[model samples]
Target chain A: MNIPMSEPITYLEAIRHAQTDCLHTDERVFIYGEDVEDPLGGAFKATKGLSTRYPERVLNAPISEDAIAGMAVGAALDGMRPIIEFQFADFAILAFNQLANHAGAGAWRHGQPCPLVARLPVGGTPGGGPFHSQMVENWLTTPPGLISVAPATVSDAYHMLKQAVRCDDPVMFYEHKALYFHQRASLSNAPEYPLGRAVVRRQGQDISLVSYSAMVWDALSAAEQLARDYQIEAEVIDLRCLKPLDMNTLYDSLEHTGRLLVCTEAWPYAGVSAEVIAQVSSQAFHLLDAPPRRLNAKDVPVPFHPHLWNAYRPNTADIVQAALDLVRF
Target chain B: MQKIPILLPRLGEAVAEATVQTWLCQSGDTVAKDQDLLEVETEKSIIAIPAPAAGVLLDIDKPAGSRCQVNEVLAWLHSNESDVVQPVDSGSPHAAPTPTETSPTHTPTASLASNSGRHGFLSPRLRALMQEQGLTELDLHLLRGSGQHGRIKADDLTQLLEHLQSHYEPHPAGMLRQAVADSMSRSWNRPLATVSSAVKMDALLAHRKTLPERPSASVYALSTLAQALKEDGRIAKLLLGDQLWQAQQIDLALAIDVDNGIYNPVIQSVDAYSLGELAVEVKRLIAQAHERQLPSNGHNTGIATVSNYGSLGITWATPLPPPGHSCLLGLGAVRRQPDWHPATQSWQCIRACEITLTFDHRIADGGTAARLIHRIVHLLEHPDLLS
Candidate 1:
């Protein structure tokens, strides 16, 4: 399904377009989740127009994440492509056993193709309590054989989602709620980027700023500030996919910048940032001028109050300061 | 007569001691205010201490070649008594001498090492410079720092780097050069094929005359090539590791010679830029490249690469595109040559240049590459097509 190139689309609209494209292209591809079929269109309405287009393919599953995930796995095993949507990424915990044990491990254990895509509405929205907001790429990626991708731009949202459905392995797709209506891109300018490939959002020489999901915008902002204020050009890389992490892009960037600063909204210890830094330090030690650094959310649980939440997460200032320190190191 | 103590000043951060390299004035020597009293050496640099007030050198408390701690009394003076120039006892009870002070005692001091650990640490920028200069910690330990508590600041490292750079041959593979090498290596692994076409620049030269700022032929070629790519999708394919990528935005990469190495920084969204805008952006990128401070990271992701060998006064040359790119364009020198003009029915003087297109054979066939070059030459000969 080709979109009219003249119009621009928001990140949410891109998700809808991606689903529509998948449903139209593949007869086996179907969307299953609670309240996803009609007027409700699920939480956040990413599937708002998707159900209207294909009533048979866009489904409304039981309200239980475990049962929904188990059903998706069974359907996928039966040679049907299933896309399971979780209202909020935080609810993925309810189906962790099914997702990690079966969907992720089935391909490894029985040589079966688990062509399933789990759409997770992730990241904190204003006033979104702890139970409603979470970045769960790390958790889903912990299991073997599962691909976790967090798209930063509308173009990536459209491109990567389509690729996720075509993937032979199960994919955990996290869409940032904050970027739902915030980011916009021209449909005409959508590049054909493949899944598991990282893109350099902004280029700089002095430092490499690596991030994924919503935090990519923050990294780009920090890089701009660094260039304007300190004359430090920072390179920003968006790790679109997490599980099959693009180490090549990160290494190539580190080898050029000679310094690396990994930024994430997730907590610092043993998280995505830590894992990236560890690999870069080990693989590109000779290329590094200083120890790699990371900017992450505060270790405390995410608070509900707006002010507390603002302080709890890593913002532009935090990333800029971390990059400045890393470059000066 | 009142005597004033001349103490060793705190040179820098964490510096507890320095060796007296020379005594500018000796006992009984009358020195004016703010005059050189002694010269001392630290781990980073050599510093010369001056007299705080005009006075007669009463005694040399810690003589030359002695290790004196910061604030240790190095000498004594009769305050404001330049006329009474009499030598006093050099060995006063207030004098504290460390073992390394005399006889060039080569004993390694653990204090300096411990001080370096906690207080006088090197910044990352300084450390990077040190690594660039091929300087080790031992070399750092040999120079005296001027920073607080004897810490090595970025400026100090810069000076050391300059000194080392002047004394030895500069490293051939600097950071930027290494980046170029890596990019070239990636490009070299690809199966490259080249196609060339000759274009008459009679219209292009006339078009440049009408513009407010007369842009170079390379700039004109860049604009025309970007237009051609935007119009045709068959030429805008990037192949990497079994994945074929289609270009959403047309970006152009220009290779600039920076005296030392070639720097190819991409000008993004070039298809949307007009001739004037392209000229300014190209000029800015060229300036940045020459300054050796171009912001080059993953920004090298251009749809096609362009090498203006003509600008460097070269004829035809084949240039390879960096990996993940499908095509590259080379512009040779435009020169006045005699050619048969069918419209004039006679030999006429016309400007002509050779345009070479090196493309990845894996993505596009020879026919596609030939068509792309043909489009570019057509756009150049008929400049109205671009406007």
Candidate 2:
């Protein structure tokens, strides 16, 4: 039911195409969530027209959020791979108990595999109110027996989704709403990467900027600014997965630059940035020349006003300031 | 106006005290902020202490040539506000300023190496002079800068170079040549002693004449030296790490010229072959070396080496044995001179060559090395003994 095209697609379209391929490859694979069926194609259209080809597979679930998760776990336990799409990542809070307590811990507790992939449209949009804008990877990753991944590119979105459905345990796939339509990546014979590995988006020698999600682009822009104005070469790393945490690549880059700057869109304390710095300081202590630095969103609720939101979250300028501080220190 | 105390800054982590090489400003002189106030000489480098602020030099606590400890007040300056106040040690308030007791009074050229910590601010010409004189921070601390804003210029470094040439005996080698110095220093780690003897080469010369293919004297000497090394097991052992490896067969490494660079190529198992075979092998190796086709494999495993410095037209010389070799035989050019025939009590002509053997004292004493040299001389003096 999906139309074919020759040109490359946006990251959102890649996610849609990956789901279509998964639905076609396995008879046990099906998509059941709110607005995922035909005429609606799910929110953000990530599952756009898949219901037309596999009508029985893409079923529209009721508005009960708890039942959606409970049923997905039940279907996976009965030998079916179900892809659940929440209308917004913030709405997942309504079903957190069922997703975390049962779907996440079911396999370990009862020996029943929970082969469920819950795709959440995470992160903020321009002028999106507090109800719609939320990044939940840092929270979802804390639960045991759950694989949390945030894909920063089109190829990653396409491949990581196919891998998530194939995995036996539960997976929380966080797709940034801000990058869904704005970001585009070439998918022509893209190299394969593992789930928990990080990628160096740019190579340098002076300082390292480790970030994930949409903040990866901001870190790269800051690295370019540092090169042009300050003559400081900054290396940028994109941590695609949150749970497994690729400390090897981080240490390798830290050994070369001797300074680390971790950036995230979440709050500063007890976030992913805090964990990264803590691990680096404990393990690669001698490799550091100065204290490791980090930049994160202000510790407050997601702002509703446009200017307040810009001030609350981290940007290229914030990343550049943190990089300068680390390099000069 | 608040007076700020100027303390001697620690140039490096290991530096405890530094000598005030020269004072750029005198007491009562008005100095600008960031201006070079004085130069201090530490063991690692020479650093120029800049003025903490625009101020007048109120008093001099430690004058030029005085050695001062870290955080010891060098001077006091009257400024609008005290921008930097590094407190001095309390126990040393009345401590007398000790003048540098180590070296003699400073000369002009030795003082030109001083520079502020601003590394890349030097002009290309000044940097070139620094590189040419091989001056360091410690050397520059002695100079009072004549350039603008305490910048050491080319002319200052040149004058320092001339002054250093007359005063200091050894010049600092640059980074490129430091490897050679390091290896030679490591070579000196072993206690070495040398012994010399004059050997008559009549039988060796006679043997060379008998062969249609005349072989060089080096091959004959190498063959006899290898035979002697094989007979003495103690001399054939090599110190490899903490353990001594006893060589199964003698490998003679000959220092030869390859593409204008001196290369020592090893002829494997030299003692296992006869003198005639060694002559052929030596000729082949030398020819291959000249063609730049000989490999340097197993060159470091040699127990002994023969250095033919005589080929360069020297009559007598002492050569430091290179590292990794237990002994080195320095052979001088053969000279034909008049000798006293003891039986006839008359003067006669004979060909004699000077040979000096240097060995590591750790493996053998002077007397033991002397016996080895004597054994080699006896073999070369009587060529029939080689068989």
Candidate 3:
């Protein structure tokens, strides 16, 4: 629990490590979902070496989410681990009927959790328009059945996926395709992310910017700029989970900063942003300097316009402005 | 149609009340006691009473079937034409009074368990009772459970143990009575005592008519009341009781009156359960009770207790502290019409259920009981707490 965060590594290496380590630790775990074979581990390059190392365990399945998730549910019922992968994050939505409705809530309601994991390649910077580029966390996080985790860094992608693979509950492993090559964190510096705990990527004193997935890097970068430009030490919290949120850490940051700005890829209304603002306001209203703020996409679905879309999600510049406005106010 | 005054039968060995089996005398009919007027079953025996003063029976105060302690009248008797006689406590061919439950005074501890403190809580007799009913030491909090402080006797846990035994279908009075002996022994160790009162259930039943359930419907008062208990403090922990060993979020029990004894079946996990869930469980428990397929227990590390006695206008009833539990609740029948509280001078019209909170003198005082009762009352009034 007290591991350090210093070294930098790529999201790809983290996920591979998570796969191999989990497969090594638990014999019950085996790979499935798509082209998880000897030569190509997956289109996202996450399962690259998994097939070679775990040839017997790595399996390729027909492109049917129902069969895949249902088969995994059966495996878990028999007390086995079934890690599934979808070629594209958006394509994984086809399984939502099973994942969210049936698989997610079946256990807690009936006293036996569905122990499965679906690793989806999520996020847009790879120039994937509505078809391929989509942050699935926005849609999959709040549902009842599975716990959704979208790791932005390599070490997280590695260890958290391992934990999820071993967890008694099913998990939605959403690794950002944008951060796969991210080397900001070294393997040595990787701190284990427990199931439900918000990590403070950058410690600040004046304002708090809460985000998850790839936005952690941007928020941290903005925190650095905000500190030097206006001395507003923005505490950047990387929310690893979209559900069963670690509200305590987030609340503490808001209490200290007295101002809140939530940054995410989803739309503001009825999204994660709404949930955060409501929880913080209800529990820590006395500490607010102004009402909590969130920078998110418009109501329209993620568009194909690269230039116009650049304005849709928050970036380093937008984050800096958010901090600046709070500082000036 | 008939008003019968339920009375406690005279048991040979310090036994008190008797659960009514069936009415031997019909609502409108001539009757003779020696002719099996009605069955009065207790921890002692299932005996019948002779007609007090043979005449055309006018009214039956205590119906044939109820849980009434000894010495209380079973029915009213009147001579034919001119003689007008009041129901006499004595000089009537009725069952005798059980000093244990009906006595105006407390009995000596020696009369309950022995002076031996050694297997105080785990004597062969006590173990037999517990094993028979499926209870454990963890079942009792503190208080060796002996009537005397630091002693564990069968009598301390007798009433509660008997209460648990009554959960079984067609529960044997001998089993209930023996369990009662053990539970009372344990209950007495702690200064915990029970206070029971009856309330009119009409208002609650009427309100129930207002909120219709979606499908598999259930209705319970204790679930709402537990929310009231929570207003006192953040819940410490939730324990489960039953075959599945599901955690009981709400610590409430429905007290059912059977022929040989009284049983209190616990409604599990009211704390985490929604009102709908509570209703469902209450319905299940009641069905089990009616079919005589009831379990032999109400196990939960409960903070409070509730006994529903409003069914037959037994508005006020005494509650026996369940073993290891701190408080017991006795709720009375809802009146067909509301009562005017002369002190408040308010015509409180909406439906109301009577509740009595019996608390451990060792753990909670009357003041604390009042606070708890206030919270429970608040929750019952605002059943939205279930939401």
Candidate 4:
């Protein structure tokens, strides 16, 4: 069902466009998840127009991540591309079982791929307390077999989501709520996103700051802020695909900067942050002047209040500060 | 004055054309002779071309990023004064009107070798092959080109150069090379001689097996050997300069050759690594050596070297004294053999190994080396110190 040649879209509009456009492009591509229908159209507005355009293709399922993941896997196995949305980022925990154990490893170990996209809404804003505001791109990228992607722009959401669906491997496609309304790039059409790839949002050399999900925008903000305040240039790498990470971009950037600072909302230990640091150090050890530093969530759970949450998570200021420390080191 | 068309200088031999990357010096900039005026790149490397004369740049003939040749005019310069450096009648490769011997002008006497030198029409296939591997002038000269006029076409050099540079070439010298060069020369020049000793290593083996493995446990026969060698006052002071000078530290490099050039990884402080540690260290070093896992570890220099060829079934072979450290005690393969001693009065099968000491002749005479080897043998024979 091709999108009715329609008007230009806002961030929300582009999201709706992403689902419908995808449904039109690949016959194998379909949408699923709880409340993903004409009446509700997903917890977020992403599937608003998709269910109407492709009735048979767009599906509604019970609130079970495992069942959702299993169905997508089965669909992919029988030759259909399926995309399922979690109501919120924290809801992804329900599906982590199938994703981490089965969907994530099947393509790599068994050589039988499970092509699926798990769209998740994440990031804290508009008083989204602990449960709804959680950013779990970090949790998803920990497994080396699967890819976790976060797009900060509507174009990215549209193009990357479609690209994620068509991929032969599973992708935890994260949509940052803060960026779903704010981010704008010099993009005409949504880009043809490449899975397991990284893109540099800004070109720089003094320090390399890698971030994803909501923090990606925060890193870019920190880059601009640092550029203005202390004249320290920061290359903000939007780590689009977390696993099968485009390590080459990080290495190439680190080769010039010789310093790395990763910004994420994940906890510090044995988390996504650790993998990024390890990968950078191993692949680019000779290039690095010091070990990579991270401005991740503290070794605690996300807080409830605004002030507590702000202190718990890394913000633009935290990213900028970490970037400054990297160059100094 | 003379009118000379200055051609572009060739960068690395791989360059076909250069996009004048940057002009460092501006027109009218007073540049001393040999001062770089511009940086140019030909895909691979960026090189800054130095000014040929001390003068004020008069004109920039080539624009930045323009593609040009090795004899093309880059810029013109005016020196302070002109003199008869060369006779006016000695017509050289220049366009001159005044016929002054030297008018502060750079005139070319030999025309730039153009597409004329190796003008064989390379086949499309050969050209592609040459373009892929990024060969250079030195490479072209090395290749036995079957193309026209013996010019190396793409295909002629591709398969062979790839095989030579990547597959057939020796892996490069690591940090160990410096130590080896230093030690070997020092030992070779020194007035050195060896003292061979046949000792039973059964006690050492038995002690090693008996120890309840612990990290803090004492180092086995090796430490005993080191301590006994220390008894000789001169043995510890200096090793063959060949072993010492070339490498950085006094770190001992034990030769555990695994048939690869860059495989050797020194056990940081062999004396400090105890018997359990020694076994672990040796095993780790050997595994890394064999699997090529010990990477970039040999930055520190080795003071002396020991080749325990005997442990690995090779017996009684002379070892090269590494460049930094002078003396190496080569041990023969330890195996069960019948040994006869005057005290025993009868032949008995025992575990025995022979040690051959190769020392620098220039630094130490035969007596010192003999004394050193004897001390080492004493420690090796008595495993109590190691235990």
Report the C-alpha lDDT of model 3 over B175-221, residue by residue, as the tens digit. Answer: 76666667677667656554433344443454556665521212455
lDDT of 2 by residue, B19-112 (tens): 9999999999999888999999988778999987788997888999999986567888877753333321111111211122112122221222
Please give, for residues A165-263, the per-residue lDDT of candidate 4 as tens digits. 777888788787777667644336546667667888898967889887678778888889888876777898987777767889898897667678888
Q: How well does candidate 2 match the true structure in TM-score terms?
A: 0.50
lDDT, candidate 4, B223-275, per-residue tens: 55455544443544354335633332234656767652433355555555557
| Candidate 3: Cα lDDT at A299 | 63
Candidate 1 off by > 4 Å? B1-136, B139-387
Candidate 4 matches the true fold with a TM-score of 0.47
- Sort by lDDT, best first: 1, 2, 4, 3
DockQ (C-alpha) of model 4? 0.01
Worst 10 residues of 2 chain A by lDDT: A1-10
Q: What is the C-alpha lDDT of each candidate?
A: 0.80, 0.77, 0.65, 0.66
Instruction: Estimate, for each residue in B210-287, the C-alpha lDDT of model 1 and write its tens digit.
Output: 888677787888888899888896778876579887888888888888876787788888878888878888888888
TM-score for each of the candidates: 0.53, 0.50, 0.45, 0.47
Put down candidate 3 lDDT per residue, A29-68, tens digits, no spaces: 9888777775767776677877787788888888887778
Which stretches of candidate 2 lie above 4 Å from their native place?
A1-6, B1-50, B53-387
Off by over 4 Å in 3: A1-8, B1-387
Using lDDT as the measure, the top candidate is 1
Instruction: Point out the higher-scoring one by DockQ: 2 or 3.
Output: 2
Model 1 chain B: which ten-residue window has the lowest total lDDT? B85-94
